[model samples]
Target: MEAKKVALVMVDISGYTHFIRAQKVSAIHAEEIVFELLEAVIDRAEYPLTLNKLEGDAVFLYAEIGDNNLARVTRDVAKQVQGFFEAFYDRARTLTEERAECGCDACSRVHDLRLKVLLHSGEAVFRQIRQFEELAGEDVIAIHRLLKNDIPAREYILMTDAFHNLAGNLAGMAYTPSQQTYPDLGTLQIHVFQPSN
Candidate 1:
């Protein structure tokens, strides 16, 4: 098997666990809200990027680094990231407002949802089983490890140092340094970019 250069991304809904617990919403209604938002983000995905899997409240996506122009690839990934958030927040606002008069807890509190993205670029091995395509390698682990961090902002995008080196400048986005240690991955340095309202 050959290693392929790819950009890995994870879009996760923040405040989901806390929101469901605090609102005391029923499982059926809670799932409905979650699935709807997840679908909205999935629907906004563009070419070169494909949805790998849905891990509960997060959607994992991957795209091969086909373009030699590193800057273009980074910018495109940033654009897709921005598009997902736009769709997510817009749909959330609409749903919350639409159900404002409703008595259901899930419907009324839908506005509490937020989104965060974790991105990294590295070599990964693609594996296929049955009808599904999956990515496996250190890069996959690196992106998932990013999900747990001490970043104060609930809604922000975090990129690994490798990704930052290639796409950070092209993104025209500002980020702050974040460092965290994982048992297996050692001390990982990341860049945090908080999206503006």
Candidate 2:
């Protein structure tokens, strides 16, 4: 399909590598817990925000922007991004309580798993390869690259300036302006929002 403006989102589990490595003996339970958390986030995704794929510890999603639905789409994506935190943490809390008696490292340390979301708006070309739909473009690369930022928070929402312009102030969030520079992608100005528990 032709390139079109799309809002991209990724909900990633923080400290995932450490958690898996630290709980090798309980790897099955750890994987199961991660799957549950991902399901919670996926359940919270509404229309317009389509699940592109599950990237191990992260969920890659995208919503196409139409000329007449820019405002509505932005609002929906923003709300969905915010809701992901609640969905993930709520499931985490329930798992922790349910497995409280279990001494497995995965059960005991579920609290360490945090969710971080990245948002970006840009152009992308969509293609269907048999059963899989793929999004390809510079924006897609940029959004994925954003997952490796130096944000000092365990859980937070990071949005590119392009997305900020489309979504406005995101209802109640007060974003802190920040910048990230990659050797290849150059500089990216971003807004960070760390939600309160």
Candidate 3:
């Protein structure tokens, strides 16, 4: 089968469960608020958003914003991700500094979510099964590892080499070393944004 171009992204928050664990209110309520905030962020972006499976504090997302030239498709995906991270960070920061303008769900839970965005692009088999987006094989697996190994808890965006190579704005952005293990591939290297800690 011929391979299709796709980017597999994984978004998750740091200190999410810990925040709920220490909360006086119900954990479900706290989690629900975070989930709602995440949903709104994705919805506002208008990027193809699909939730596959939730992994603890993490949320799996598959975004396909229509197809364009393969190169442009990948770069745009990175830009879209970068933009989303900035927007989310701004929202969270405003809430933290007590400058939040809205009293909505996002503002309320803004302090609870610190998002880590990971992007990995490669060839894949994309099949729309009913209301689901199912992508399988090494491409999918590779992207998952890219997200897992590259993105740190506090860092905003981590892009695999394939993604960085195609992303338009690389020269100005900082890059840091990222190494990880894959099922059969053993050790691999990628790039991650340096946390300005």
Candidate 4:
């Protein structure tokens, strides 16, 4: 199949490593909490934007960009990104209240968990072999590589120049200029939108 232009996104649970590294008895509850948080984020995904796969503490998603739906899909995804954060925190808050009686490390530390989103626009070649589907390309690698960066924050929305151009105003959100450098990819110009909280 021919490669297609698409918007790639990843919603990651920050501070998950520390939260999940509890004792064996508490690990089960930690996993359950992570599962709940992940479910909340996944539930916010809408049409045009599909779940490509789950990467441990993160969800990888993509939306194809075509002439007919370019504007609509970009706008829809931009709004959907915002919705992910809202759903995540709302669910987290509810979980915190419900689990307050419990003294497990995972339950007590729910507030430490944060959400980070990464958006990149690029071309990808998608393939399916039986039930297993995979996306491969330089862009795909770049988006995944972005997960490990010097962002200096646990929660924020980071978008590549390509994605920022397509996503437009992003509901009139303000973003600051930032850059990430890798040995191979060099420097990537990114725009970061951080919550006021």
**For candidate 4, which ten residues in a row score worst on lDDT?**
166-175
Local distance difference test, candidate 1: 0.84
Q: Local distance difference test, per candidate?
A: 0.84, 0.91, 0.62, 0.87
Compared with the true structure, what per-residue lDDT tens digits does model 3 show for residues 1-197? 33566667777676676677665554555665566556545654544445655666566665543346656666666666666666666656654556355444434555666777777776667667787656777757876666545343566577777666666444456777677777786776567774332
Give candidate 2's error at residue 118 in angstroms. 0.5
Q: What digit string (tens of lDDT, one per residue) describes model 2 on residues 1-197?
A: 67888999989999999999999899999999999999999999988999999999999999999888876797789888888888998999999999999999999999999999999998899988999999998999999999999989888899899888888776677679999998889999999987866
The global Cα lDDT (0 to 1) of model 2 is 0.91
All candidates: TM-score: 0.92, 0.96, 0.72, 0.94
- Report the lDDT of model 2 for residue 81: 88
Which residue pairs overlap in candidate 4's backbone?
A: none
The 10-residue segment of model 3 with minimum total lDDT is: 99-108
In lDDT terms, which candidate is top? Answer: 2
Q: By TM-score, who's the top model here? A: 2
Candidate 2 TM-score over all chains jointly: 0.96
lDDT digits (tens) for residues 2-39 of candidate 1: 67888889999998997678666466677788898999
Clashing residue pairs in candidate 3 (N, C-alpha, C atoms within 3 angstroms): none
Residue 98, model 4: Cα distance from true site in angstroms: 1.7
